[model samples]
Target: MMTRAYIFLNGVGEKEEFYKKLDFKNSSVYCADGGYRQCLKAGAIPKEVWGDFDSVSDSEFKDLEDSDIILRKFSKEKDSTDGELLIEYVSSKNYDEIYVLCGLGGRLDHELTNINLLFKYKNINIKTEKELLFSVDRKYTFINKKNKIISFVPFSDEVRNMNLKGFKYPLNDYLLKRGDSRCMSNIVCSDEATVDFNTGRLLCILND
Candidate 1:
């Protein structure tokens, strides 16, 4: 398997089992400031930790200080979120994929913004206890979706010529928009299913 950069965002303790199920082999762990505390709680060592120490408690920061990990601190008054900064840094590392943990289920605006960050990379997957979300800029295929129902959401204003094969509710070159629900809750009929789009990006989510 290709190595993955695991991003530890805030709200790390929201789902314990999900973090436990994360595959860490050949993966470097990066924590976004306060998420480092959650990393310690999960008993995972972070290779690098970055962010302003605002959200992190004083004791937690001290805990990190006691460790010998690479720490990069920034002022609270920053241009971008800590998660975004870490993502950019990880992108530069040329990892095969970026797996984001605890990026969801936060403040409403923050959660939505985190989802938007999926567009930042072509090979990023956001995992939470409730769902597994990833973006599809061109085409994506999933095997073992025989009896599974996945949600196809258009990230942009419209994703033109969206097509799905081996699905119960097959869509051939269908147009999907932000408000369209036709593609939602589509059932997969075959062992191997495909979702392809000619132009634009969309989000695919498999409910847990």
Candidate 2:
């Protein structure tokens, strides 16, 4: 059995409803600051609530005073953001994979930051209502993604010797440079589409 971890970020109320459909039964769940309220609203309790508590309301803090959930508080003046710190902690636990929920559709900076984290943590992925974001360095295959829309962006200066098999727009030993949109909005043509690259990282986005 592959171990999994879920981290919830602070998102708008509209996103709270999406949480209800998530299956967290066998996964470790954690919240970053204000995300605790959203997690609770979804009828799910996190194992720990981590952050500086700047975004959490006083009333909310009071509610957690006697709760069994662990609180990992840090200084507001810390160099790293709450999300980054929480991710580091989760990555250290040696889980097979980590899914970050509600990480998108928030502040633009935070959204980009979450995407950037993909390069640092090989097993971390950003999951939103409409998209799944992950990073691939060597080879990756998409199963049951036939005809689904997907895109690949070069996360480094340039992606070398990239090859795409079973896609609408196929690439053969192509070099994808940064800021390139040539590979955007491609459709998977087979049941299993493959992405291979010799060097550099590629950010893969599966749009729903």
Q: Which candidate tops TM-score?
A: 2
Per-residue lDDT over 1-208 for candidate 1, one digit per residue giving the tens place of the 0 to 100 score = 6778888888646556666777765579999977787777766789999999787898878878898888899988989999889888887788888878778766777678779888886567887777789888698888886878799888788899988998999989888888888888888899999999888778889876
Candidate 1 residue-wise lDDT at 124: 74
| C-alpha local distance difference test of each model | 0.82, 0.87
Taking the candidates one at a time, how many backbone clashes does each contain? 0, 0
Query: TM per model?
Result: 0.93, 0.94
After TM-score superposition, the amount by which residue 50's alpha carbon in candidate 2 deviates from its true location, in angstroms, is 0.6
After the best TM-score superposition of candidate 1, give how far the Cα of residue 79 lies from its true spot, in angstroms.
1.1
Model 2 lDDT-worst window of ten: 11-20
What does the lDDT read for residue 41 in candidate 1? 72
TM-score, predicted candidate 2 vs. hidden true structure: 0.94
